[model samples]
Target: MKKRALLIIAGLFLLTSFPVTGGSAKVTQPPSQKEEIIYHIFQRSFFDSDGDGHGDLIGIRQKLDYLQQLGVTAILLTPLYESVYYHNYFATDFYKIDPRYGTMQDYLRLIKELHRRGMKFYMDMETQYVASDHIWFRDSYKNPQSRYSDYIIYTDKENTKPLQIVAGISDFKGYDGVTRKLVMVNLDNKEVQAYNYQLFKFWMDPNHDGKFDDGVDGFRLDHMMDNLDNLNRLPHLFTTFWNPLLGKLRNINPKIKIVAEQANWASFGMDYLKDTKIDRVFAFRLAFAIRNFNKAELIKVVDSTLIQTPKGKQQIVFIENHDMPRFSDAVKADPGKLKVGCALNLLIGGIPSIYYGQELGMQGSRQNFGITDANDIPDRQAFEWYKSDTGRGMAYWYKNGPWWQHNNNDVPNDGISLEEEQNNPQSLWNFYRTMIRLRKNNPVLIGGAYKNLINNNDHVFSFLRYEWGKKVLVAVNLSGDKQDVVIAMQSAKQIKNLYGIQPVISENNLAVSLPAYGVAVWAVK
Candidate 1:
């Protein structure tokens, strides 16, 4: 299996894309603020700065030009607060910046640079859980008379042992091999609520100047939920916990957009939108259906999602993220299928979030390497910065760890690094660039309503993204064999080729012949 992958890697990958129109097309008005193409970065795995082997705020600041060139309007970073864990989930302190990732000054500078380029920055925050070393845990634990008592959930009347959220959960073993106890915070506590508001407000305007230039544009609520751990300890939190806190945050910064990672990935997230103040949620169903490559499943999920989502709210679409296996792994490294995934990511009608390193076909899977956090290290490896796998900007933070032996996918000369793909016009990275530019250039693709286009072929997925007086047809062949699909349409002869691939007009209907794993787009009146 490894030999076959190496052989495929040697050839590199080829994808066809042409400039909109024959060349130098007419300019159109840009899309609204609602159409932000978010580039989600696993901050630890992104580019390194200061030769620290760890990705830092200054490092991200240095790559602003590269991110802007890729056409992403905003960046969504993983939690940056102080945490012993490598992923920064079990934060020890919500107010302090992770020293390894850089200082608070570096964070402000990164946000400043992002806003200067007309880009937005979204900070990831999860406050429901904390490390055992946190002040609230340390000061309150086993101390019922302590002022910070009731800040953490304790089963005993004496307030000794904090309620364990994860089953059989003990001290969390960090990727660095250090163990720290994890605690579930008491969300129902009023003081905790007040502290949460203060923390959120502090990030909104860190300088306290009220100029808002240095603050993050919004936040990604990590593992947001109404019920705490389904233990029935904290229920109806949307009204009591979230809405009140979020409403207060909005009062401080009305424009602060919050996207929730709903606790249940299988849910449609209408409840989160309807019951809470969240602006958006990840469309996991659509993502799963897209990966499955089944026409019926895609249509079913998309249709249901579109119909159910309320006005003024949005669904974030992507093939994979920090928690799941890379899309390349899902398709077993098929270059064509990878391109298909990219096309759908931008061509659909939703806020598309391109995960960092996904553009270069980065590969990893969720490993069952025991209960320790190391199991997630496989999917969260360093971003491939060089084809040779060694460079100044390489964020290979896991190199010296025990998993170093298991950084099995980080092969030299595999042609999966940004260095190899950035310059190659036919590389997957360039394909991502082309698709992003395509979506940004076309107004209909941004904030457009989605409609499934009926096609005879099961291997092909067709949809129309339409707006007032502007309509675009996108057809993708998700299979390994060429496919011919007929779509019902009238006056289709005037179809304009907005992309390299297009179909012929048979009578009054549209006839599209897509090569194996090919994607095409056209403007149909």
Candidate 2:
């Protein structure tokens, strides 16, 4: 079937580069640079070069080639600091990488390796609460006026309310057994306000001179929204905490990128934080829907989100993360749907994040506390890298990490491994690789203006991406039946390539017989 093509771009070329000249010749060339793409790594799946089960910083360093192969420019690692739990959200010490994951030297080696490959890294650090076992917490509990005294906000015993820890792996008693003194950060208390300011300084200031150092490149702020009740209050917190941190980090390295998880807020919040030195904020709502086969819903969410994000601030796109349901498990374990989602995320504006295991279609869910495992590791488990039936290395990188405990041990779930998928051209891993290529080749789709095409058919989603006189129309058949879409835009004239189906026009209406859950893309003539 002939698909209707929109007048996307006047010049449709794959990749543009200047021709080389003889060694003796001096020729001026345009600056060569590409936009950046950051990939998220779960601590468990990065590498197992030593035949260990756990993924350490050295493991990540070993797989830089794999990450570079996907054209990812940066890496955002979940917390690697000292902690009893797996995810390391409740940090025991921000400065120390848990011995299980590797050592500080390992992290330094990782940073050096990534930097050598022209890639950057961001560490997830929780600035709010420490683990119950944290020395600061222990010291504060023992003596109210101890060294860690100002770290926590102390409230009067009579007025303190019982607080329960629900999110992380372990629960700690809060204010229940306290009789004389109760402490909560009095953000309201101006005298103790420095406590909040000092928390950020702990990351930046090595000498405690209120100056940020060059030790780390960037920080991925966890639970950034917890301190403030509303969006308006973010700016003050940013100026006091984030802006200085960014400035300090930049002082050490100018190209550093700072990002945070607002958790709950409009995309416009990125704009508010931009002045505060935040480079990006993860687009949560948009990416969550893409984890499922909801094209129409994803389109709407992306459109609304981009509208709210401030200019120059990125809409960090992602499908799954440590906090959400594993992407593979959400789409009924369908690889096709996963590919389509990957295409959309890579092609959309702003930076794209590939949550760990998204490449292998890892499946997971939350039963009691919602998607969290028994170890309190957010449902994201250790990477399974066993050899496939073909004898390819499924996970040579995870030789040191422990295998994720499966809900059903009887099932033959170990058959699907990365090395196996790497050899299979039609596997989910290859599909993701292809989508990343499309995004890298087509710059217009990355930052282009999105015009969503709405029609009577709910299963078909069509949209136009126009930028710099270039146009590309993208349409996806989200359902099983063939859809006869009447082209509302008369300018759609010729056809390019359908993602997985042949486009044939019928009855003068660009009738394309799209396969079940198929996608079509037309490059404007």
Candidate 3:
């Protein structure tokens, strides 16, 4: 069945290619801002340089030009630490970079290259858990006399069974059905806290120099929640762990941004921001609302998030990430829907993050709901660089893996490879590139205050972005039918179309006919 699926998918890709257009648009240098456009990259699947079929720091360094061209001011990489799993979320060594990624020197060179190109780097860090092979866990598992015995949360004094917060949980298994024993760290342990702090500091400034040229600009704290294990194991994590750790890091580098992936996606991350003082939090609700095309819910979520979030704190809005299926896949690979998603993702008021290959309209989804190592392999497939399955930069390291064999339907010729899209102005990739350029060029769209516009039509979601005498009106048609809607924006001296058809403005009312999945953005004076 899987082989048949792969053949069908390949046949779909082999369809007549869209005629390539000549000439690419040149984008200007974006204005400097505290918040930036970030590109989230799964390093293992991004670009491989050593022909090892795995992406490395050197490969990322070589692609700095590509990132710069994409207008991403920063890049957020998944964990680079040694791990037993392919994702590297569970750390085996706190101090060492995964040999699959590169050595510490290679990391330093990548950081230096990013800095040279005026781009910042942020690494994902999940310090709550460690693989069974991790030295701390290995030493603490059976021996009570071991120095690291108190580092993890064990059910008993003898430390026989690691604390199972939820009974009979088997969600942490790897792709190969191998049960991954990831013991949660006891953050209350002072020694454990100290070790984590040092590990964070080492990555921030590896050389101990006051000049942080070779250091990371920030970290994305993964699975961060006030209560761990859902058993109230670590209830005061924010006060006891995050606050002090963030304080010390800010003392070391005030510009460092620490973003949290709130454990509970349903709730707004305001508590994490206000109490813990983290710089940013993922807007998971907004992301889901957008993905489902719930315009009413999306507007309400955006309004509440913007209105309720405290000052000086930012939200990182994204349609897809490492954990979820690609936006293109979610939207069934419709180019129109992809374009609509791109407009909302880039133009909406927040720090937008583009998942790698999102611009190319990549399609993939987890194959199984059961805890298996191969589940996420579909979502983490190699980036489609060219319009061919086999290409120069394709990272097909997982070709022989069970996950790849089971779910390898997504190929370069899916009509959305970067090479194919780069030459077509109407491609999703160009739409994203153009929208990003527009966002970077317009300060009002970047950091402006968001106001949900009153519109009678449910499918037409309109909003106003205004800041200090600059205002922009944005409306997106979420449905697949032409809709005529009247917006309540009166004071419009000049109007400029950013996407879709231009609007018709009259006294105190703005009317526009939007095609199915049409988007319109206007700079209103």
Top-TM-score structure, candidate number: 1
Candidate 2 per-residue C-alpha lDDT over 35-64 given as tens digits, one digit per residue, 9 for 90 to 100: 577788886645654545566777778778
In order of TM-score, best first, we have: 1, 3, 2
RMSD of each: 7.7, 8.7, 10.3
Give Cα distance to truth, residue 75, candidate 2, Å.
1.4
Per-residue alpha-carbon lDDT of candidate 3 for residues 1-525, written as tens digits (9 for 90 to 100): 122322222112222111111211111223344447999999999999889899888888888889888888999999999988888888898788999888999999999988988889999999988878888888988888889999988888887788763344423777555676768799999998898889889889999987889999999999887888577889889889989988998999999999999988898898888889698999999988898887657866887776677777888989989999888888998877898889988888778999998988887887874655578888888888888767676787678756776554455466768788888877888888889888867877887777766654667888777665676789899898998887765556678876667877666567789999988888877
Best by lDDT: 1
In order of appearance, the predictions have TM-scores of 0.92, 0.77, 0.91
Q: What is the lDDT of candidate 1?
A: 0.82
Q: lDDT for every model?
A: 0.82, 0.58, 0.80
TM-score computed on alpha carbons, candidate 1: 0.92
Whole-structure CA lDDT of model 3: 0.80
What's the residue-level lDDT of 452 in candidate 2?
61
